[model samples]
Target: MKKHIFTLFLLFNSLVLLAQESYFPERNAVWEQKSSSDFKIDSEKLNAALDFAKDNEYSGSRDLRIAILKGFEREPFHEILGPTKKRGGPAGMILKHGYVIARWGDTKRVDMTFSVTKSFLSTTAGLALDQGLISSTKDKASDYIWDGTFGGEHNSKITWEHLLQQNSAWSGELWGGKDWADRPPREGDIDDWKFEKPKESGTFMEYNDVRVNVLAYALTHVWRKPLPQVLKEHVMDRIGASTTWRWHGYDHAWTEIDGLQMKSVTGGGHSGAGMFISTEDMARFGLLFLNDGKWKNEQIISQNWIQQAIKPSEPNVNYGYMWWLNRKGDRYWEGLSENIYYAAGFGGNFIVVDKENDMVIVTRWLEPNKIGEFMTKLKEALD
Candidate 1:
């Protein structure tokens, strides 16, 4: 009887702790916070894993299973997420071992990662290339654009690369007020915010969510199926990600976004954060990327893509197609010589690939305002 009473008390205390995390003010969902010690993988082994992560974080490796349990609170790196005039939180870090070294986080974890979803979306594009579903990135965007009539002359001049590079130069604040009425009404708006479509296509990175959303539309057309279907065969099937892993906008486990899925501009419309997965799954993803798209014997993502994806070739932004570049760093690689490439996600998510060291470091945070400093420190540590 004493033990039963104690267990109930513990659960009650956990409920109270969970109750503290909600902001809805009305529907407060209670959950207990676990510490890193509660994780499936041991934290002590972290250092031992760094060497492997430094070596093969790109490819998906099943034999490597050193998952780390990182129980830490998340702090927003954004100056905006600072004190609610109520409380404050700070970012924390931990490292994990497997094929490559990685760090995991556990705090008010995993908010929507915004444009980072573009990287996932780009995987679908890469698969299209792999399966020969789509012919080329050189194709004209106007061809797939809903308004095919206006696609003549100058509009046709815009290539899919322009769209990928965000060089198409569409300057409307894709997230703000609605000035654009030429297109259809965006989905999921309780209110109608207008957007002004920037007349220019590539002069500057004046972000237009609609532009990337157009890629969703194009993928739908080229694949002749929803973007979700292609993602299943190409990425999910190959990676062995958790079933709990879900790509939002995909209706079913089998049925994909068949019709008009990618029609809207995803940047503003679909923040990259919608896709959810466990931190370990994310590390697997980072590893696959680091490995240049090899998951076991299956060459899921192509070598040409791994090479092209990492290359710093875009004209305007330091950003690559969907992948971000860590190009400007010193000529150092795991105490060797190799260029570093990475998939940088908004809100402090990074899959840092140190090819020479054969290491891939993946991090998640509410906002690690410390990213810039942290990366610098990390690179130094590896060197």
Candidate 2:
């Protein structure tokens, strides 16, 4: 009898966990942003933001140092920031009835943004497109690149469109299998990728790290400045991100398009990881992008660049340059348009831009609900 009861209890816990993971409590969510009578925002939804902020540690900047000794690396999360300092969440908090509008957890603080760095890189490519530097997106990326594999039969047909879309069917051991984990985590980050055979290219959209490195090679080789410097002038500096945040190429400078000193990218690298900024500042970026790359009447990132960056290039998997699109339901939710896009990172770091509603939501945390769950929640909120 006790065994049966234990099995039942375990089953119940499993069901609850599954529910939290898959089933979203939509009606229970509310908004709280009220104060501005001019803006067409749901006061109740804004109120929900207020309630969300009560729990997270967003009122402070956490610091941490990673030192190497004894041939090992040591990192402590809670102790990194050395006890959190006091900070106001954000002016007119959206979670708690229009009080604070910002949040930051340990992971969101000093942690690195891995694949996110790609978004920045792609944005630079957009600027190049808008500035008339690259001319057109149709040109094969291999023309500017100088790799043997890129020139071979399959890759020769691949275009810039393919690389940005991750649709480049470059033949490598990485994408030719089902268990991607068995292949190296990153070809550019470390020497873990075990490449064996080569096959046809530009067939499917699979996550490829080395493809980004190839893009860096193409862009930086043409621009004549390292990808980091190009990013500084084209994206970061324009976005008012002079903060300590920055991008790092790779340790193998020969293989890396941009290289200076060897160090972990401040917050994260590009792609899944990259430039780190305060959640407040990150929201500012989204605000600028949502408003067509202008802030206080200054054309930071060109309007053309903004459109090219967020505008969907293809509908295969719903991606534009480096941003992701909402998958479920209609495009218009609440006052937001279907054109809304987001910069998502591992561990639930999100920078959402809803141009239709003039809303830019940014969330940073070591952990949040699962990726799909959180995105669905935000979509539901807008809907």
Candidate 3:
């Protein structure tokens, strides 16, 4: 009788675990508030987390829009494809089990997510791979880009994986921007940048926006359609993202595709005008990835693709594809799982996803370095 009771106990525990619904909010899902007691969260710790985010908010340039344009090469900035937009202040929402636990500032205000746009760019590549638009990640990028872009022998050796991992070291100009000029080393002068030897593809991991833009251009040629449309039809709309988000490219980035002049969207807003999206839409995106590219039982981005995208590349362990990983003590925090990964951008925009705790923390302008502190305190609140 005791043995039978033990069997029944195991069955009951399994059922309980299965009964817990994995929340996926609808297009009109409201931010229904619940007491800390209901979610087993520490009220004190929760308040502390909120306080930390509020206190250490983004204290950068107040007019980043004007400042960013002035900082870059003026002529090229003016020649870029799309118009730049103004940015907003510190704001974000913390979602636990698909419900907003805490939100601060203006969560609905759309803002430039900087390099966080790389994560979306990476997702587009995942979609391409899923639909067999490209055969494999290891395939030579030159195979798809028949144009003289990857003409040189060195650049020809670059693979899709190399580009996605930011180790391609792809040379040549795209949309009037030189590879070296993208993000030159701070210590170096123009001559130093001009003379620097380029590393072999997949060897060095330099965060160059030009190389990233090159990846965007190559993907554009493959799809023969604008990236924003691909994203909206496949991923964003399915995930219930708002129409406020806009992916902008430069002025000269336009090309005649399928008899129409289409702009090749950029990977980020390095030069200006990248993904201007709201925190709520960003949360939905984070939730999609947290559930491994599935939305309401449909596989939007392949699970295999996501697994590959997140794995640590040999060049940089803390970076996978375009997403930032928490491996090797980078972005590590106590009381949080080591598997935590996030989409980080310039000016402290972050969409931090913790799969273990089923949480997605979106913060805009929260002081880049202080993210670890904020997350550490926030995780402690989850009890």
Best of the candidates, lDDT:
3
Compute the lDDT for candidate 2: 0.49
> On residues 1-383, what C-alpha lDDT tens digit does candidate 2 reach at each position?
99999999979865663343111112112322234333323446544543453344322232212211110121111122111112223221122121223333421233444455667677667767777777777788667666554676777877777777666755532112222222233335322333434333445555555565556556665675666676676655655553555466444333333553322221223222245555544554565676676655567677866666655544343566777665334332333346668776643456777554445666654233333333344444444
Candidate 1: regions farther than 4 A off:
1-97, 100-103, 107-111, 144-153, 171-203, 249-273, 329-338, 366-369
Find the 10 residues in a row with the least total lDDT in model 1. Answer: 66-75
What candidate 3 gets wrong by more than 4 Å, as runs, is 1-19, 69-82, 329-335
Overall lDDT per candidate, in order of appearance: 0.48, 0.49, 0.82
Per-prediction TM-score to the true structure, in the order listed? 0.60, 0.63, 0.91
Best by TM-score: 3
After TM-score superposition, the amount by which residue 307's alpha carbon in candidate 3 deviates from its true location, in angstroms, is 0.5
lDDT of 2 at 381: 48
Top-down TM-score ranking:
3, 2, 1
Task: Please identify model 2 stretches exceeding 4 Å from their true place.
Answer: 1-47, 50-110, 147-149, 172-203, 255-273, 313-315, 327-337, 366-383
Model 3 global lDDT (CA atoms, 0 to 1): 0.82
Encode model 1's per-residue lDDT on 266-302: one tens digit a residue.
Answer: 4321222135544555555666775678766668889
